[model samples]
Target: MKEYIDRKEAISAIREYRGYFQDQKSTDMMLLKMEAENILKDLETFDIVPVVHGKWIYTGKEMWRCNNCDNEIAGYDKMPSEYGVNYCDRCGAKMDEVEE
Candidate 1:
């Protein structure tokens, strides 16, 4: 979880997240927006602490781990347009980029 000091930034973050959810075109966004708005509305009353979890779950992206050095690289939404993508970060080992 991350903390924010500014309330406007927090609201903007939630709105941007709402956009991401809306981009998926799922009805779940309606419920999510309700929840987010509720949280924002009560921000001043209940200490305003927010926690985001589930980072431990493995998300399917082209996440790479350098086998030789154990360094991890988060994948971008689109694959790089140039060259083979096995270039390593640490020992310069050409590692496989696994989905998830």
Candidate 2:
């Protein structure tokens, strides 16, 4: 069975691999890149996408909040972008002017 890790541990592993490659020689960096790819592949199996944020990798899920009702939504897909901006599902408020 595949070993599952929580989101916090996954982010930490990515950060560690990132730090490991910072000052390495070109040849060594290539090897490190391979290792990093393996880590990313493992994370993919868990439905977690890594996004580079400045110096750290973060979960790619973005949360959108409803300004009218204060409802928060989050997921890899099925986000507000998938739905039309004309209405909010929870409160039926107009969402056309909502900014990303």
Candidate 3:
């Protein structure tokens, strides 16, 4: 059996081999190159990791709220308004309070 190369050495060799394969597409060269790639892939079996949690954060848009001091509220993404009390922030409350 052939001896296994260490991961770093294997990676470097694979990079070199890929460059050579790209430049020369002969059948015998491709076979050898593919064998080298298979070995590298085997080395990769030890490298996978599962993502646990708390991996990201969002810091984009401002918080949306009800136009009135009403208990209900709406997010900016859901409903957008130009002026005050365009729509019910809570439960789609309408502008019932008329103005002079």
Candidate 4:
């Protein structure tokens, strides 16, 4: 049961709250503002997104493309899968899903 939030929206809301309370000088307000600032910092950090996984999609008789990245693999004599690749060479998507 994972949860998610819109990072951009959360950041914006924190910014708005901090801005709205900028004129306050009470000790509790100051501490809350500092916490809000820390929250904004955390919200702005790198995303924890799920890894994009996909299979190879056949595009032509001699070409197959990565479904996650659309990076194409070209072969002259044999299909790309015959080369025994386990991952996409360009985007590094794990090649474990069914080939199309």
Best by TM-score: 4
Ranking by TM-score: 4, 1, 2, 3
Query: In model 3, where is the ten-residue run with the lowest total lDDT?
Result: 51-60
How large is the C-alpha RMSD of every model relative to the true structure?
Answer: 17.0, 15.4, 17.3, 6.7
**Deviation (Å) of 54 in candidate 1:** 42
Tens-place lDDT per residue, model 2, 1-100, is: 6466675665556545656457888678767666765666675554744322111111346656666666565552444545543455577655545323
Residues 1-100, candidate 1: write the lDDT tens digits.
7454666666677766745456655667767866877788776633654322111112348554444565566654433223354455445554444446
User: What ranges in model 4 sit over 4 Å off?
Assistant: 1-52, 76-79
Candidate 3 per-residue lDDT over residues 1-100, each given as its tens digit: 5344467677667656655357555777767866877777776334433322111111236344443443443344433343354555345445443323
Off by over 4 Å in 2: 1-60, 76-79, 82-85, 98-100
Q: Of the pair 1 and 2, which is ahead by lDDT?
A: 2
Summing lDDT over every window of 10 consecutive residues in candidate 2, give the lowest-scoring window: 50-59
> Against the hidden reference, what TM-scores do the models get?
0.29, 0.29, 0.24, 0.41
What local distance difference test score does each model get? 0.52, 0.54, 0.48, 0.70
Candidate 3 deviant stretches above 4 angstroms: 1-9, 17-25, 44-100
Write candidate 4's Cα lDDT for 1-100 as tens digits. Answer: 7677776677567656756567778676768856866776675354675665767777876788888888988772454555787678888887778744
